[model samples]
Target: MSDTSGALVLFSGGQDSTVCLAWALSRFEHVETVGFDYGQKHAVELRARDEVRRNITARFPQWADRLGEDHMLEMRGFGAVAQSALTADRAIEMTEKGLPSTFVPGRNLVFFVYAAALADRRGLKTMIGGMCETDFSGYPDCRRDTLDAVQTALNLGMEQDFIIETPLMRLTKAETWGLAKSLGGEDLVDLVVRDSHTCYQGDREHFHDWGYGCETCPACELRAKGWNEWVAEGRPTLAA
Candidate 1:
């Protein structure tokens, strides 16, 4: 039997996180998924997470035994401080600094910290997140430097050797799609397109080949652009 122990993924039931989840499952003998109720405007992604989990387990039963239960955390005050389209009911727009309205302040920081806490308690040493700088909406926390700093801080503060992994950190959105297809083939791609939610507005009605969303929001635009670019390049093998 596989060692059946490895890492936890900071899963958001979005395209990137779902791909990260698949990546973690491929490498780890055991994997647990964590989501946060951070008072985001698009809480629908939480529901989508459940559905995506079911789809993954059903389609990839070989991983069922090692795939642990989902962990949902309540961050009651996140919306009060984050103050973005993800937490507010306003039109999705960009900030003066070129960041999209969905850029929640220190959101990824809190997420990584809490995920580290969970890992410490569970004796897990690795935690994976899906934050990407390429093809992103200009969120500062999604950058590689931020993640690196957070990793260092997490170790110093908790006195634990936790290895935070960002599998999608460098991959473009199109490359992410390609990586998913490469890792798990059609099943993974299907789950991402049909189940993952990346819309700033949580618009589920507008379905596209890339995925479903408002199709005009920053998230959808980025996804669509990536898909187009991928196609233009003959859908070449995207580097991880």
Candidate 2:
């Protein structure tokens, strides 16, 4: 853990970002959270982000000491057009085809743009995210190549030294579960399952054999599959 390295996490109050948040907390001396509200279907997830931040602050009072100022930043406006199913007026059929309707155009680009500006202001060099290629439905932004390109662009555009870190980029959802369990406590991962929102339709209470995933949407199916595999392997599954 480098005491000089400051990290800004692109958090979304979902399972992936929650795990990434915990990971950033362990490595960076200064860990800050930046969330975006692009008018997604699950607007409640933004509320969940605030709840998770409150829970984190309550559990780790020392975290306040870690973050000097601008600890948590939330940005809204610049809403995504109805290009994808995520914000379209009609419901998106959940599938792995081309790209999901939930795919917000230039979402990562917008997020990193703001994060890089903040990093430059704070004299930070690292921006962390939970974009994973293994479990990505079809979003181009979640790919390793896309991240690499974006990193280069951010540095050149801002003329500031910035490194985008995707710790779970190559890991599967099951593998991400393992990482979260190891980095944060197992309870943190359990909190992710119970509290994080990933449903495309904003279904929070829907639960299956795999926790709170809606059990219907593609995101839920993937999450449920990963959790079931983790449980079947007896790999210290989430608490019930």
Candidate 3:
């Protein structure tokens, strides 16, 4: 058995959450992961999640031993109500409008509500996520202020003391890449690009200059811009 100070991470099998997972392994005595099955169009994302669990377990089997198998909590029904292009029938369009069609309404809210319950039951006071505002274009839930409000609401509704920790909230995507490289060696970036899921369309068969980032989409554009800047600064690029 590991130590008692446990943490529950809302893992999405993406670059940011993978970094958080590695960070959690180093900090907590016991670290557990919770992933969602939100019925996103790309079933490949779920497959990617499985791959991420396998890789994490292989890398840190001791942590796996202590934490048990990765818990992929199912919320398939909830996804039916998610009308956003990211998880629904609508086409994902790039826009400078208020929010993108990919923005799933109340996604973070739903994730943390369930995470709070799980954490409270397991005596885990810390709940970590990978939501970032710096590079995020228009996701309301990814904002720092939105997270703070949700944190307060979760504590009030649950009547339990819990901390929603967002280590990547303030860091730009480039900075996040740097942090992951620092923590898990430079090779970790390659692991993220190959294994992690970030595409709104859920395309995984191709690799762009910025890993799986779809070159045409806004997310891909931002990620590509950041990676180009990082490389222009003579940073190392993780190979596939």
Off by over 4 Å in 3: 1-4, 60-67, 94-97, 236-240
Q: Whole-model lDDT, candidate 2?
A: 0.74
The digit string of per-residue lDDT tens for model 2 on 143-221 reads: 8898889999988998967888898888778877877777656666767777777777788776655556567777777
Models 1 onward score TM values of: 0.94, 0.87, 0.88
Stretches > 4 Å off in candidate 1: 1-4
Candidate 3 structure lDDT = 0.76
Candidate 1 lDDT, 108-197, residue by residue in tens: 999998899898888888899988877677889999999989999999999988888888888888798899888888778888999999
Candidate 2 residues lying further than 4 Å off, grouped into runs, are 1-4, 60-64, 67-77, 80-82, 94-97, 236-240
Best by TM-score: 1
- lDDT tens string, model 3, 112-139? 9888888888788899898998888678
Which predicted model would earn the best lDDT?
Answer: 1
